[model samples]
Target: MEDEAPVIYGLEFQARALAAQAGETDQIRFIVGTQSLRQENQVHHIDFDDENNVINKNVFMHREGEMWHISASTVDKSLLTTCYNKTSESKAEMRAALWRLPGDFDDVQSEDQSSHQSLSLVCHLDATDYGDMKSVMWHPTGDNSNVVGLADNHIVVWDIDTSGNSAQMTSSAGLESKGQPKLTCSSWDPHHNCVQIATANDTFIRGWDLRTMQQTYVIENAHGQLVRDVDFNPNKQYYIVSCGDDCKVKFWDIRNVGEPLKVLSDHSHWVWSVRYNRFHDQLVLSSSSDSRVILNNIVSLSSEPYGNLIENDEDDDDDADDRESREASPPQDGVIATYEEHEDSVYTVDWSTADPWVFASLSYDGRLVINRVPRAEKYKILL
Candidate 1:
């Protein structure tokens, strides 16, 4: 049989948020960020075929407010929401509300009610407002009722009740810095009993223990410039990765806060986002200001024996040979593939939670590309 061709698609409005629904392989959703002369900001749902062709799409407009960040629940695939920071001459408030999915798939409707019934507000917050909200994320575990939002220099946690009718502030923590850098990103550690949260601020990557509400660790000078994104390895407890304005992607072991385990400098411009494949821990995806998306194999560096050297041979000559063996090995965290299909700066790249080989990238130029990692390269495993 002939090889299947790759599938590609583009959007007219910049995508501010791109999320692949959990347990879904053929459909993904995004929010249009930039308002155009002809088109207003809207939420879009798109479906693709096996060949990667766009098959279906649904678009809806949010007339009440503008959205800055969006997050979907993993436990309940039907729930997706956006956070808005409304600033005006009189007051500045931040709130999060659900996006009513078009059609009969609405989760809010009762069994006896029709889908056309008016949608109700899911969450409203007035006491814990921030100046400029940057990012928001739903907790990976639990019932997905908890959410964390990054604004200014503080991180605020909120718990949504089962009904989604009300949201309550659970806790808030301030970033430890002499001069507060804009909090750019935040992520939850996926491992069990890992109450750790990671945040990227300016040139630093800091970790916090939510259990005690204390700063657990800090890696200073994490990036040459402001760090734009950070993600923890879902399968590994102590591993994390970050990207920033320095145009470099760096990996770190959270247990050792001194230095990055590996630095993958492939992008020629600012790197905006880095995400690890939830299933394939060794694979990472990154998008850059150079208008390109790159996939990397992180298995090599992750397999290295760091701080756990076994000294079977006690002779000095044997020890020297062992050191040379370690030094001669080629660095593992290298760029495996690059996708330069975006016309503008690629802002976000998200891997499908259901399929390890399939991933998506969204750019500031309003292009969204769904791609599958090459089959030939997929079988290579680190021995």
Candidate 2:
């Protein structure tokens, strides 16, 4: 396969949030929300077509408020969640809610193209009157019925009844200390069948076991500064990756958080996000305020470094060639690429659900750049 140029798309408004659409493999789709308090905010649906090397888009109006975050639902292809800024009693407040797309979204387009359809309302998530809603995370598994909302000093799990278009809080835990330290970020534990969650509170990484609504583990000072994002290793049971303002991306085996399994100081500024490839845990991505996206191939720490190997008892020659090919590719344990396509701070980077080699990054300036792994690197392991 030949290497191709990275595809770039710009939005009309500035943005900081993006999420790859889930449960679909036909098209490379991403959902982005705009942040503009002065004008009407919008939700952008971007589709990247690899065969033609082009992008297709659809825009929907979000009349509620300025958007801060967006999350696509895995169980329902048409449903999504957002955390938005709104004016409540002459004060700015953030809230979370579920919105759905029209059934004919794929085929529907206006004649003028200027008039856009508004997102259908699914439900409004319940939150404290004063706490600022940071993000609404869907379950780690395919089930979207249960969602956890992280806000100032609190983490709440909600039971969403999409059929009735309503949400009810099931359980919640508040951080109590000398000063109520606000929660920063969190990820649902996929290893525990989504019964536990790992949250970043300031510099601390705390694991919450939802079965008993109790704290299971706490990693004090996971980072020197505020933790920005945490993601679970999809293939590994207890492994997680975290990044923070310290400009370090640390991988941990949640069972023992005393020391990180590996630490990478690749970004010069604050590391805003760290993600593990859903299929290949060794492939990691980190975005930062330095306006760069770093892709790392972490081999030894991954569950499988050389892909699945089947020992052959009959063909000695075939096995030897296989071994040589694996050796030649040698697991690259360090940074592979630093993408500086965006001039503004990159808050999020996500791998495409449709294509493993393809991923996208969103900057604060509303620029979306979709890029792929170098073909030479992609063929190293395959050949």
Candidate 3:
């Protein structure tokens, strides 16, 4: 098979928020939000046809504010949450809310990209009493009944009633220390049926139990500087990954938080996002403020460490010229591949729920690139 070039799509305004459209297997889809202070912010529904290498999009006007972060429901395709920057009386405030697409977000041909339909308001995930909202997380595998939001100084949990189009604040926990400690990002613990969650508060990483809304575990100084993002290993129950301003991606076992299982100092600037491949946890991805995305194979610590391995090892007997070439820059398997299609800071990278081999990355300049696992790497895992 020939190598396919990445399908590129551009948005009107600068953006940093992106989410993979959930619960669909037949199509590759994602939602991207725009950030503009003077112009109306927009939410774009993007669809990629892998066979033909085409990108289709639908645009909707969001009159609220500049989007800070966005998340999609695993159950409802049209339902999503956005943490936005709303300015009132010359004061900028970050807020989060639940909104619904006008109709048929998956159907690209249903409406033209210039329809300019206003987003339907579902309900307000009001965290005003708490503080500025950072991000919202939905249950990975459960129904769309409960959602978690990271506010300035609190992890606010809410129960959504779609029938009434309203959300009720169920529980919230304060996270403050000597000085003001702001919550940066969060991840839902996929282990134990998603009962726990971890939040990056200041430079410390803390876990909380959803049932009691209390702290469960703490990894003090998990990163040398501020931690940007955290993600739970989907296949392994205890293993998790984190990246931060230290420009390093570290893996940890929450059970033993004293030290990290492994660390990779691959990015030159702040590592903004890290995600383990949904099906193959060994395949890891990390995007950085240095405007690069690195794909790594952390085999030894993966769920299937010994099985279907040795793809890179098979090439060890190559000629001396090949060895010299590899020393300068290696192949896609174990040597890792750095994607540099964006000119701005690449903030978010995600694996496609529909196709395990396909993934998407969004940069701050509103460049969305749809890429796939290297064919050699893909065949190595399957064969």
Best by TM-score: 2
Better of 1 and 3 by lDDT: 3
CA lDDT of each prediction against the hidden true structure? 0.70, 0.86, 0.87
RMSD of 3: 4.6
| Residue range 1-383, candidate 2, lDDT tens digits | 66798899999899988999875567789899999878899998888989898988888899888888889887677889999998766788888999997643457543345778789998989796539899988886666578889888888888989899999898888876557888878888887668888998889998988867788888999999999999998988899999999999999988888999999998999998888888777889999999999989887888875555334457556667787775677655987788989999999999998888899999999999999987876765455
What ranking emerges by lDDT with the best candidate at the front? 3, 2, 1
Q: How many backbone clashes does candidate 3 have?
A: 0
Per residue, candidate 3 scores C-alpha lDDT tens digits across 262-355 of: 9899899999999999899989999999999899998777887654343356556787777566555532335457788888999999989899
Model 3 regions more than 4 Å off? 106-108, 307-333
What TM-score does candidate 2 get on C-alpha atoms?
Answer: 0.94
Better of 1 and 2 by TM-score: 2
lDDT of 3 at 317: 78
Q: Which stretches of candidate 2 lie over 4 Å from their true place?
A: 109-112, 307-329
Query: What is the Cα-based lDDT of residue 147 in candidate 3?
Result: 95
TM-score of 3: 0.92
Best-fitting candidate, scored by lDDT: 3
RMSD to truth, every model: 6.6, 2.2, 4.6
Give Cα distance to truth, residue 282, candidate 2, Å.
0.7
How do all models score by TM-score? 0.81, 0.94, 0.92
For lDDT, candidate 1 versus 2, the one ahead is 2
